[model samples]
Target chain A: MIDRLTAFVDRLRQVGVPVSTSEVIDASTALSFISWSERSVFRSALAATLIKNGTHRPVFETLFDIYFPQMVGELQQEPDSEQPSSKNDAKPLDDMTSEVLEALLRMDLELLDRLAEEAIARYAGMMPGRPVGGRYYQWKVEQALDMNAITERLTQMLGGSGPGGETAGSVLTALLAREDATARMGELRRRIERIIRGRLISDRGPEAMARALSRPLPEEVEFLQATSEDLAEMKRTIAAMSRRLAARLAYKHHRTKRGRIDFRKTIRRSLETGGTPLEPKYRHRTNRPDLIVMCDVSGSVASFSRFALSLLYALSQHFRKIRSFAFVDAIDEVTHFFEQAEMEEAARRVRTEANVVWLDGHSDYGHAFSQFLQRYGDALSPKTTVLVLGDARSNFRDPLAERLHEIRDRVRKLYFLNPEPHRHWDTGDSIVSKYSPVCDGVFEVRNLRQLAQFIERIG
Target chain B: MFESPDRVTAALKKGGYLSDAEIATSVFVADSIGKPLLIEGPAGVGKTELAKCLAEALPARLIRLQCYEGLDESKALYEWNYRKQLLRIQADENKDWSKTEEDIFSEDYLLGRPLLDAIRSSDPVLLLIDEVDRLDLEAEALMLEVLSDWQVSIPEFGVIRAQRRPWVVLTSNATRELSEALKRRCVFLALEYPSIEREKEILMTKVPDMPEALAERVAEVVRAVRNLELKKSPSIAESIDWARSLIALGRDSLEDGEIAETLGVLLKHSVDIDKARGALTAK
Candidate 1:
């Protein structure tokens, strides 16, 4: 049992959940106290022992389910059942499996999908028990389907079929032209694996499935394509991140640096030691930089704006002042909304009630910049850090890059967070290339990882 | 020590605290292994109350240290009674200065704070450090040595080890992340708001005079308020207060006016009250 527990902890650490040695010992001790017959009790006991941060709970639960599948009342068959059947091993591919191969040879994706599902079900059901270590059923089903033969046949058929044999023939040739047959087969294999994993999750438990499905690494999930649920999870992760950042800042703030000595304090301390200057006090400076955040709240980068605002609001205590503005074609100062409401509510109101969207509902970086300069330019100072979040997509309009440069000159530091990938920069109406040179830093923040790195630099 | 999680649950229930198995398991494990348990959750989720109940269940002395900004070793662990030392020095002016200084800096002149007090106690102790996240990093760093070793070092005396290791509980609202060095030395438990059924039982247990229907209504309203995006959701204690207020007012069920008038007991902020009023009225 101790070996099993330690191995489970190892699996958790492998998946990026930091389970310390002390926690593993605690979990081992906890396991002995709880009734192993009650799965929920056992699971919760382990969770309480191993998981310190709530964000890591999903990863811990995933590893727990994978390691302790018997707790969920699945995969309990004898170990020998996992071995290949002697009769099936002696025989070649069956007729139904050949039919799937035939469909794949014709590049009949529709027919192949149906036949693949049937073949997977038939082979997976025939498996005596769940495979350990690797995905046994998926590999077995793939081998049985003989996708290599289908690929070989398709290569030959497409080579002879010229450009006008049929729509399917042309589609196969076109697909092969874009990607080699080997790569296409690899993609098909991945699709089959996904199906098999889905089935396994359903058979194991829905609770595990729910956690596993949404447990994408926070840095890897693209903000643009995240669903509302994914956004919520991301928000939770970011909240944890901001708390960590705040703690670090607080730690740094508490470490009083040795500045110019205070002669008066030193003289006063000399009195206690009978005119011997024993202790000296130094003057320390507290740098609380004012922040001015201007986020583009148009449809394209609204998610990024919301996420960044939420994170900044979490770390609001570190700054002396934070003034926020949202813009599309016109700019609107939404700092009051944040002061009047909670962070989430303020972000929502800024998105809906602010006059960021103009009549055409197109991003006008030039108009927005000119308005900000005209209205709130006086707010910028040498102690202020200006953060501009957007894709810099100006719809072929004047970008007013000069106005950004002017703002940059007034502020102590100016940062540009472009949510679009760097490869997309300078493409279409994105004027990042024009604006990048003026800012202190222009970061490609397509996902949370880059955003966190940018914040760490500024923070 | 509690024999098992079930025994801990039974003991806590006997002490009038309804604890789930997870909390029971955490308390049991912390007691058995002699590690501190770190409980973090939103405010008003009974994180502190769990400590109080554990003390009762263990029938031990409770030593609480409320943490805030600028908490330091002098306040948390120990401090020298400088005034007493000064008086003693004046009285012993004829003695050698070095000997007098050594005598005054001894344990007799030391004031044991909660941390030191818990360690020095002969009886079993439950040390509850409330809102630990509010402490600055320096203070938290000071705690690492004492908590990890169950002892305190005074330069005047020597290391003061605990005669009986106190079961420790640290609660946080997560205002800031705790250092990993602090977190790793403890078992962690997160206490969210209970389910409606479990909450109804809690309400009935705490407010026995209230009608069942009224308890159900209160739990329902609290659940609904929790679902809304409020600055602070009504905690279980607030729910009990609201229920008791309704019973005190000679009401058997909720009326819109009564809920409106007594909403302040549940919702702390005006913005949350306004939002809850809109939600309640809509309902």
Candidate 2:
């Protein structure tokens, strides 16, 4: 049980939690005092030591409960007292699932947790000695796996396999739940893609990224690091950023006095003061620039789109009227998802709403740009700013500058925010520079600072 | 950072700030009318102080929030004083319990942080969410929730809305990227180390007592040492310390001879000192 507890702490550190050797010591000492006969007492003792920080408390508790569960027989479950060779096992996932299933068969909670971690780690990969955000996500998976183990035990008692025999929706859900290898890889690829794409596009300006990221002290990183990876947290962060960006305005608040005067306000105020200018209030009708943000939500840029759209959505919120959309090979309007509520549901809606009717599902700016002109050209007047966020990696396809030229005429500004580095701008089937001439503005958005500067400048 | 928005841009153009892409973005953002500037960046690049300078330039009060390890609604936004409520309850012990509970959790006892205080203040307030990256995901979510509406929700008290939308500046160290929800709430700026020329200028202006030649040398050594892939990068704090140390020692110039010896005046770790020494010698 203590070994299981130690292993759980190590796992927590991987996900982003700061479980120091001292913390492990505290947990071990606390564990030694607990009466093993009483399961509840033992659990609390471990929790009191391991789960110290306020932000980290919940995840630790969740992980601890999942790892150190209550079962029918604890000692009898593990045969021959020797540990399993987790490192050498090529099929850690298979081994973990099978071992956990066996633990479930025997109804041993502590062993189940160790096996559960092995299962999570099998797909998630071994975390470095230090904790990070990715580990937090895996930790969330661990929490769910704990719950799943309990449910599976209950199901086994009732005579069944994993979550109904259908193996259709539940399979994807279960697969997605257990060691989401694809999503994790996709997330990493998306970050690298954005960082790269951000470098490739036309310059937003110097200090653009810097202003967006600088701070006086550590905040979320500290919290995130302390807590470790919480999948729920990762989801929440992505969702929160997405929601903010989706409805974000170009202008937070505008008081435009550009080559004009407040005739009505000036006249009304003068009249009120008997033509003696008591108070000259400027006529400021806040202008919320309508945006059409289209991203190549392909495999590489999917995660970027997730965040970019969220930020774009956030920017949209500032405008009196704004609309947002996302595209992989095809386009779809997802502006309705700007609200704080229904964010995760919104990410789900991205797939359904994006009409997958492209001839090729690769990067085709020509196809996407042409589609916009044909389907929505009537709405593409000078009043609107057409923003395209992509790597512009058309996979060596015809870099059609014609459609882009047409977009330049129709829209007030054609801005392309790319995530590729500058060196690869003209390489790898990427036709970024070809479309650059038509774009009123172009930028490389690598991090928060770059993204913030991009958003700040537009409206 | 370079005195004002204009100066900062100029420094960028002169190659004072190496990252040219961000300068154009800054000009666009500063020139932008009627937008609550949201500046996020790494620590020591100046997030709260930007607002302070903005406050100095515009002559506004710099309302600030120094976020901590476990900052919450009561600390960051508003919280009712139960202690005051207890005193009131003792004074009015015979009064209705249900009515008292409702009355006590009202605006009368609502305390304010930079967020609410900036909103409630009649004067212009440059609201700074300092070290916002320190806030939890929940806290960031909470701040985003407030930023979206420019109004905060208090179950006990009513929604506290901004009378006049205050100038808001949020700072963060990409310790973790903020939620897009938070990002969309305002304008964005990312700050990194100022270029050697600008840093020297900054040093000259901020610390006039330091010698001009010494300041230039300080900037060069700091910038050079920072470029190395050490365990910990030398920060602005180290630069200032190095300058102060040089002056305190009555040293006329920063020589290679003395530099390798007393690196503790600048770097915190011996490994970093070794790294700096290696970098300096390699140079």
Candidate 3:
């Protein structure tokens, strides 16, 4: 049990959950107090000890299913009232369809489990050592059972309200019945997936299945390779993370205000106390820097730029003075959008309303930098930190390193964030080499984790 | 004080808080192992209510420390009565300075906050630290120190240890990420909105006069509203309040007219109420 538990902890760490040694020990101690046969309580015990963040629960649950599966090899044949009563009488799918429907209507979970097992054994064709994914087996089982027709029939039968009556009470009754049916069918479908996963785990082992099935957390998904779902999830994560950062920043700002004690002031105030320095005064330091963020809203790294802009503006209240600009071929200051709306809405307005495109839509770093200096050059002072976000793909235009150098000399600090990998930095049309030497630091920020780290370091 | 997870569940149920098996197991383990349980969830999902229910179920005296921004050690843990100390020093001015200083710095001038009060109490205590995410870094570190060893260190007086280990429960709405050292000392539970069935059970338990069909309807409508993209979804308390309101108005069924009249009881925001009205009436 200890060996399996340690292996599970190792799997959790591999998938980005930082389970410490002490937490693992806590989980091990929790294991001895609960019954090992009860999976729900056992899972709760492990979850309470291992997981600290709420977003990591889904990943932990997936890894938990792979490690401590529902069943090992095959179903232990236990006959009960719901079984078809003839031990080996092998009935076909067409005949048992009504039994399955009956079980679903009654919402008998144990009966559904048995039916799911029989269905997987007979129709899924999941052989040992097969390299098929779990989704394929689930699809096969879904097709063999004709689940769509079953669901439709179940819905029709379970709709308790009469079709002719359209009163509000009857409508609510129908809605509740439909919801009940959907929940029961969802349970059945989940059981089928878990049973298939169990068989596959016994065949392919937990590690292989874990590697094949584990979905990347939103932070781990690269910004350049994110799908729409990943983008939506990343936006939510950014909103929450920025809120926390803003809280911490507010606390840090107050902590720094009470600076070192001024001995001169303390002694001056203690003149009435006969040379006893009774009250010490602290030197108040107000040193919050100004910020200017320039994002490249071109075709390639548009999502990355939007996410970066959203995160920066969400914590904009903490800065002394902050300004934002969006650019492609031309540059436009977009600090007003964030001031009037939410971050997501502000990002949307930047794409539609902002005049970021001039002749063509390709990114031109030289023209944008010169345009920034021409318009907002006076805005850059010794207290300003300028952040530039883009891929630096200038479309074979001017590789203007001097323009960035001029901006670098005007600001307190200059940082470049490239959404591309470090290897793809100096490739065709990419002028990262021209910009890297001019800035204080050039970082490859390809994912949310890297973006958050860069923001923390600069904030 | 509970014997097992089953007893904890039953006691919570009797105390008007219906919990699932997962929660029961966590509460049991935290009690047996003597660790603080940290509960994180969205607002109005009953995170603070769980701590209150645990205190009632245990029949222990509740000592709450409500956390907010700028909460510090002196306000949360303990503080020195400076005015009293000054008065004592002035009254005994002609005496020896060292003896007067010793008299002023003793336990007479010590003010015990909630954290210290729970630690020094002879009776059983359920220390509820509510909204712990609002605590800044320094107070959080102080809490970590006090929780790990169950003792508070005062510079003037020595360390004050716990007379009895209190059952600590910390609740957060997840507005900020708590420090990992504080989280490492506690067992964690991530609470979400309850299912429709559980909501119905809660309604029936809390408002005993509510009918079964009305309770189910309220639960289903609340679940649907929660699934909508509203700014603020209806919480579990809102659901129970809506049900009780229905019973008060002598209404047995939820129709369009009734919902339009009483929708404000469930949804606080006007935009959410408008959206919920459209969705609920459209069905």
Q: Which ten residues in a row have the lowest lDDT in candidate 1 chain A?
A: A71-80
Give the candidate number with the greatest DockQ: 3
- lDDT of candidates 1 onward, in order: 0.74, 0.56, 0.80
Model 3 Cα lDDT, one tens digit per residue, B99-119? 988888888889999999889
Question: Which residue runs does candidate 1 get wrong by more than 4 Å?
Answer: A70-214, A217-225, A236-292, A298-302, A306-323, A335-354, A357-367, A378-387, A391-459, B255-258
Give per-residue CA lDDT, model 1, range A260-376, as digits (tens): 888998888666545668668676555566778888878777677667677555545234377878898999988777654566778788777988876698899888988999999
How close to the true structure is residue B165 of candidate 2, measured as C-alpha lDDT? Answer: 67
Off by over 4 Å in 3: A73-103, A143-185, A227-239, A245-252, A256-299, A302-360, A363-418, A422-445, A451-459
- What's the distance in Å from true for residue A252, model 1? 12
lDDT of 1 by residue, B33-75 (tens): 7789999988888898889988999998999999977577878
Give Cα distance to truth, residue B271, candidate 1, Å. 1.6
TM-score between predicted and true chain B, model 1? 0.95
Give the lDDT of residue A242 in candidate 1: 54
Q: How far does residue A200 in candidate 2 sit from its true spot (Å)?
A: 16
lDDT of 3 by residue, A1-459 (tens): 898889889988888888888888888888877778888989998999889888888788888898887665443333122234443677967777888998998888888888887787767776667789999989998998998888766766776434444332444445555666677789989899887777777767888999998787767898777777777677656766655554433444434436788888998866645556876867755456677889998988866776777666654533446898999999999988876455567888989999999879999999999998999899899877788989999999986789889999988889998899999988999999888889989988888777667655654
Q: What TM-score should be assigned to candidate 3?
A: 0.79
Alpha-carbon shift of residue A305 in model 1 (angstroms)? 3.7
